[model samples]
Target: MKQIRLGLYQFGDRLIMRARHDWIVWTLVTAEGQARWREERRFPLTVTAAGIVRDLLAS
Candidate 1:
């Protein structure tokens, strides 16, 4: 799951990610950049997307 999601931030100068599910929501922000929300159709995917959005928004 982490491997696939890594693609989303592959080009960024820096990345702040969130891991969803039973694990704690981890947010590490080093920059204040813009982030767009992506609505997902799959449950597992959506969890990841929303987590990313929250992580970015928190930045």
Candidate 2:
């Protein structure tokens, strides 16, 4: 089974943050945390359009 850990951090302007450990995935749904990842702007490590939509609907 796959496990995911989500956390929040301080950053600038985005909406979520994703982090991974060993084989587990984590998503930090917050403005500051998201902003940090966005500013980095990396592809494979970046946010997914579909994921954002799914999260919105779930929320």
Candidate 3:
């Protein structure tokens, strides 16, 4: 299983998602900027895109 950590920082109008896994980081910030939320859920990406969406929406 891959480990994922999500960090949300309040800027002006963007929800910044900083995710780190295995020393590699991926980031995405919402253009509208909303309150952030995060959780660790185990799912196979090959099985469904829902997991990807879920992680993003989880904030």
In terms of lDDT, the best-performing candidate is 1
Q: Rank candidates, lDDT, best first.
A: 1, 3, 2
Query: Which candidate leads in TM-score?
Result: 2
* Residues 1-59, model 1: lDDT tens digits: 32225545434435345445524332323345554333222345435667667778889
Model 3 clash pairs are none
The stretch of ten residues in a row with the least summed lDDT in candidate 2 is 37-46
Q: Whole-model lDDT for model 2 versus the true structure?
A: 0.40
TM-score of each: 0.22, 0.23, 0.21
Q: Residue 3 CA error for candidate 3 (Å)?
A: 28
In candidate 3, position 45 carries an lDDT of 50
Better of 1 and 2 by TM-score: 2
**True-structure RMSD, every candidate:** 12.4, 12.1, 12.1
lDDT of 2 by residue, 1-59 (tens): 22233343434433434443212233334553332323222343225665566668889
Give candidate 1 regions above 4 Å deviation.
1-47
lDDT by residue (1-59, candidate 3, tens digit) is 33334344444434233433312223334556444444444335534465567778888
